[model samples]
Target: MDRPSSPAAPAAQNPVQLYGSFHLGEFELALPIDALQEVVTFPDAIARMPLAPAHLLGMFTLRGLLIPIVHLGSFLGLPNGTDHSEARIAVIASGDMRLGVLFDRTGEILRVSTGQIVPLRHGSESLGLIESAFHLGQRILQVLSADVLSRLPGLPHVLNPDLAQQASQRRMAQGSRHQAISFQVGGRPMALPMEAIHEIVRFPVLEHSVLADSRCRGWLQLRGRPVPVVDFASFLGLESCSTEAADGSDSEDLRRVMVLRRDDSYLGLLVDEVDSIVAYLGAQLLPMPAIRGQAGLFAGCISRCDTGAHDLILVSAPALLAEPYMAELAKGHHDLYLVADDELRDVETTRQRARETWVTFHLDRLMGLRIEQLCEVIDYDPTLVRPPGAPSHVRGVLNLRQTLITVIDLRSLYSMKEAEDLAASKILIVEHGGYKYGLVVDAVQNIVNIERAEKLRVPAMVANQLDTELRQDLREIVDLPDQTTIMLLDSVPLMQRLTGNGGGSTVVAALPERVVGQA
Candidate 1:
C-alpha cells in the first residue's frame, strides 16, 4: 500500500484562517468563518415543503425570509441519532443563497495557518462538498465548501433579490401606517394609538375614595400622584370580562391598567389583558357603522387579523376625553390630587426634567443608547451588498428604500464573539452628519426611562478593561435595583469615530458604493 504524501509547508507570509467547527455524530466538520452567518437554536416550528427531497428538513422563517433547513446527517448517509432536542442550526451563505445545516453541537473557532491544511487528492468521493482536511490534535477536521453545499442537488435555493424587493415595498408603505397598542376590553378586541398611551402597569391595590363608583372603580397612587382608575367596560356599557370569582377572591393575573396622561391629569383604564402592539396601514381602517349609544367613541374599525375576519374597535382618545363624565373625573382628580399636594407637585416637576428615555440592547452585556439618537429599531437584514475593499467591522451596506445605509457590527468592533442568533438580532438605525448608519446588536431588550441621577461614571476597574475606543465612547453606567447594570454608549462620539472625525482611528474609510436600483 502506498502511503499518503505529507502536506507541503506554506509560505511564511500565509495568513491564519478562521474556521467555525461543529459536530455531526462522531465526525467533526468546519467551514470558513466568512461563509457562516450565525448559529441558532433548533426551531420549534417548521413548515414542511411539498415535494422536497428527503434530506430537506423543512423551511423556517429567519427575521422575515424563509430559510430551507437541511438534515446534514441524513444527506451524508449517517445513521440517525435517537435524540436531537438540543440540536442547533448553522446558517451558511453563498452569494444570494442561504442554507441551514443541522449539527449536534458547535465547537470552538479553529485558527489554522495554510500549512496545516492537506489538499484533497484526485478521485476523492466528496463530489466537491468536502474541500480539504486538517488535523487538530488527535481528530481530523473536514472543511466543507459553502458554494458546493449551496448548489447541492435537490436543495432549495433562497432567492434574496425577491425578498429584498418585498422589503422595499413594505418600506414604501410605512409612511401611511400607524402603530397601535392592542388590548382586550369587555371580551372584545380594541386598540388605541400608541402615542396616547403613557404606560401599562399591573392592577395595583386601590385606595377607597369618594370618587369610587360603577364607572370610577377607585384610585391608585402612581409615582407621586393619584390616578383615577375607571372600569373601562362599565364606562362603555359592556359586560365585565374580569376573571375574578363571584366569591370576591381576586384573580387579576392578566388584568392590566393602561394609563393615559394629558398634561398634569392622569387616568387609568382597567382592561382584561394587554395584547400585542400592531402596525396597520391607514387604508385598513374602515368607517364605523352606525350603532346605538357609545359607537361614536370609536373613530373606526380595523381588521385585527390578516383574513379580515376579526375586527378591532379603534378608540379615539379625543372622543373619550371629551365625554362629560371623563371631563368631570379629570377635573376631580386634578383638584383632589394636584392642587392640595404643593410639595409633591414641586418634586414631580423636578423629576420630570431629570427623566430620560433610553433604548437598551444586548452586546457582550446590557447596554443602552439614548432614544433621541436612534431613528428606529429593525430586524437585521441578511441580504446586504458587500462592496470591494470594505472594512472588517462593516458587515455590509443595506439598501433601505433608495438610500444606502452602512451596517457596523458592534461585536466585531468590540472584539466579542460573533452573534450566535442572527435571526434574533436587531439593528439600531442612527443618523449622524446627515447620513444614516445601522449598528448591529445581539437583541433589543426594552425601552426604559432612567433618571439622570441614576447614571454614574464608569468605574476605573471596569473602564481599564475596555478597549480604548470603546472606553472613550462610554458615557455612563446605570445600576437598577434588580442588580442589572447597563452601560450607556454616547452616540455622538461613537458616530464621530466611525466617520473619522473624532479620534485618530477610522472605523470605515468610506461609505460603500451605492448600487443603482438594488432594492
Candidate 2:
C-alpha cells in the first residue's frame, strides 16, 4: 500500500540510515535499526493477562525480560491475514518502553539516505505512527518511530516503576530456585533436576546386555561406552503406556533417554517425550504424598499451577540411585563390565584422551571451531557502525566492552547466499595475533567434545573442488553417532589465511586503520 508521498530528491551528501523493515498485513513498515532489538521466532507459549486490552496478545519471557507482545495489525486497524504460526516478533525499545510487535514476515535491512525520506505531516490519519516515507522502486516504505509507538494511548506500561520493581524482586527470588528437565512417563508428569542430567538423547538401537530385566530395558552405546537403559515407568512401579512392536521393541516415536550421571558412572532413564525446562522455588512444591512401593523416590510434588496440566513428581536423583534395586543394578553392571581396577583406569583414560571441545554452528552445513580459539559467543548486535571503504565481508565495527571489534560475515567470505533474517544469528568473538574479530554465524549450536579418533580427513574429491583457503580451513570432518557430520574449522590456519599470512590468497583484508587503532 502506497502512502501519500512527497517525493524528495536523493542527495549524495545525505547520511545513510539503516532501517529494519517488516511486513504487517498489506502495509510495509520499517523501524530505525537502533530502535529495534533482535527479531525472534513466535514463542510457543504466551501467558495471557487478565483484563488486559484486546490488542495486547500477552507476554512472554525473552532472555529474562518480560516483554509484552501486541498485535500490530489489530492495534493499527489493518487486515492482517498472516498465520500466527509463521509470524515473527519484532522487539523494539524506546527509553523504558520495550515491546514485541507481531509481524507477518521480516523484510530486508534498508539503507536509506536522509534526503530521500519525506517527513509525514503531524496529526495525520496514522496518528504519529508513520513518521516518514521513502521510495523503494515501485513501492513506498513507511517508517514507524518506536518512540511514538511507545507513547501511544491504550498501550500497556510494560516497564512501569511498579512492574519493574516486581520483575526485579521476582528475578531475585527465581535466582535461588532450582531448574528441572520436565518430561512425561506412562502419561504422568515427572521431572529431574538439571544438575542430575548428563544429556538427553533420542532413543537409539539397544543391544541386549546382562543388565536387561524387568526394570532395565537394554544397553545403548554412548561415546564408546555401554550405558544401562532403564524403563523409568517400570522402575517407578507404574505400568508403561507405550506399545511394543512384534519384535519386542518400543514403538513410540517420542521416546527419549535421559542420561543420568553420578561421577563417572552413567544410567539412562527412558521416558516418553522430553518437555520444557522449568524453574520453581522450594515453597512452590507441596510435600510428596505417601504412595506404597514408591516411597523415598520423590522429593516433592509440583502443583499443576507451577507446571502445566498434571502435577509433576520431582524425582530425587540421590534417592533414586540409592534404592536397593537400583544399587544392585549398578553393582551388577560394574561387576560384569569393569571387574578390574585396570579396566576402569583404561575406560577413564580412553574417555579423556584426545578429547577436543568444539563449538558447533550452522552455515550451509554443520561446522565447528575449536572452543579454545573463541573468546566468547554473544548475540548479534544490529547497531554496528558500517565503516566506509570496507570489504563486503566486513559487516561493520561493533563496540563490545569498549573495544571496536570488526564483525565479518562468514557467508560473504565463503561466497554463499547472505542470511535474510539474522534474528537467531550469533557472533563468535575470536582473537588472533592480538586482534579480536567477531565472526557472524547463522546460529551457534551447543559445545561438543570430539575425540581425535572420531575425526575423519576430508575426502580428496571434496577437497579438490574448493579453493585452497577453504579447503585447508575445512580439512577434517567429525561424524557423530547421531548421524550428524560437522566440518571442523582449523582456526589457526583460518585466522592466518584471513589475516594474509597463509600461502593462499586472503578472503579478508587487513582491518581498516580506524578499526585497528580503536581496538
Candidate 3:
C-alpha cells in the first residue's frame, strides 16, 4: 500500500465511527459499517431454497462466494423496496453467514457517535432485528444488528466456532469489567464509570457564570469551592430535556449536578435526574456507531434490565472534561478560590495549551480532513473529462495549470450514491507522497481550531470491530460543543484506494509525462 509523504500523525484519542444508512420505502435504517462488506446491484441469477422462510430471497453467486439473500422488508413487515431499478443489495457478514439484504437505495455513510444511539421503546418489541434507534432530523432510523439476523430460528446454519470464540474473548478481557453510576438525560438512561466520579451531590447552591466556557451551563459552589457545570444533555449534543411547553414556558426545574473531580480540578455536569449505582460487566456493554456531525459522549451502550428496558449509553467522564477549554475553565475557577496560604501554596498553577486545526467540509454529511494532508480547495467541473477503465470511485481527471489531478467522487469512495442533483460542488486538492488528487465533496465548510487534549484514542476493540476500509482510513473523531462529530480522515489509505496500491483497481491520471508512477 502507498503511504503518505507527510510524517505519520500520533494515534487518535477518539474512535472514528461510521455506519451504513439505507431505506425501506420511507423508513430509514442503519447497520454497523463493520457489519456491511459492500453495496452491489442485485445478482443476475438467484436460486430458490427449498423449505426456506418467506424472508429468505434465495442464494446468489458474488465474486465466487455463495451469499444468501434476505428480503428485509418482508421480515420487518414493511413495504419491499426491491421492485424499483434503484434497488441494491447490502452484503453483510456475521460469523459464518454471508447474506445480502435488499434495499430501495443506499444513503450516505453516517459518522455515528455512540451517544446519539438510543434504545427502542417498549412497543418496538415487534421489531425483532432492531436493537436500537437514532434520530436523524425529524426521522428516526432503526439500528439493525446483522448478527441477530444470522441467528434467526429459520436460518440454515450456526455461527462458526472460531469466530464466536474470538468475539467472546474480546468482550471478556481483563479490566473490561467495571462499576458504573447510571442516570437519565432527556428521558433516556445513561451511565458513567464510577472511577472518574468524585461524588453525587443534590441541590448544590448554583450561580450562573458569565465568563466560563460556552458549553458550561452554570457554576456550583461545593466545599467552599466553585465548580463549572455543563448541562449534561447539551454536553452530549441533545435537545434540552427541559424544553418550553406549547404555551412557551419552561417546564421542569434543574434537578442535580454530578460533581466530577480529576486531581485538584473539578467540573459539574447538570443532569435531568440521578438513578442508581450498578456494577456492569464489560460484556454487557456494546460498541455503538455514532451519527455524523456529532461528538461521542458515551463510551458504550449498556442494557442493564431485560424486562422491556431501554439501553443505557455509558458516558466517558474523562473524555468529556478532557477538552482543553474545559480544563482551562476549571483551572480558572480553581485558582479564584486558591489562596496563598501554607495549605494551598504548594499546589502547582502553571498552565499550557495545545491546539490543532482542520480543514472541514461536507461529504454526504459533515466530515473533516487534517490540514497536513490537504493542499487546497477549488471549484471545478469534473464533467469535462471521463477516462477509460477508471474505477467507480474515480469520476475523471482535472488539469489545473497543466498539472494532472485525479478527481474522485467522495460519495462513491464512501460507498454512497452519486449526488446527481448537486450541480455544483467543491474539490479538495490533497496530496500523499507527492501524488495529488482532487476529492469531490458536497461543499467546503470552514477551518476549525481544537484542543489536542480533547482528542481521545478510540479503544482498540472498537477499531477491530469496524470493516477494514473504514478501520484503517478513519481513526479519529472530535465532538464539538454544539453536539456534532467531525471525523479526521487519514490520507494514506485514501490515496491507496485511488492508486490501486492496495490490491484494487487504480485510477491514474493520463499525463503527457507521468509525474508519479502508480504504486
By TM-score: ranked, best first: 1, 2, 3
Per lDDT, the best of the predicted structures is 1
Residue range 48-104, candidate 3, lDDT tens digits: 889998788777765345677788766544664445455677878787677788887
TM-score of candidate 2 versus the correct structure, residues matched by position: 0.45
In order, candidate lDDTs are 0.73, 0.72, 0.63
TM-score of each: 0.46, 0.45, 0.31
In model 2, the worst 10-residue window by lDDT is: 1-10
Give the clash count for model 2: 0
lDDT-based ranking = 1, 2, 3
Backbone clashes in model 1, listed as residue pairs: none
Candidate 1 vs candidate 2: the lDDT winner is 1
Candidate 2 lDDT by residue in tens digits, 257-374: 8776554456788887666445566666789777787788899987656323467789988888778877666656655664354464467556655667777999778999976577
In model 3, where do residues sit more than 4 Å from their true spots? 1-353, 457-468, 500-519
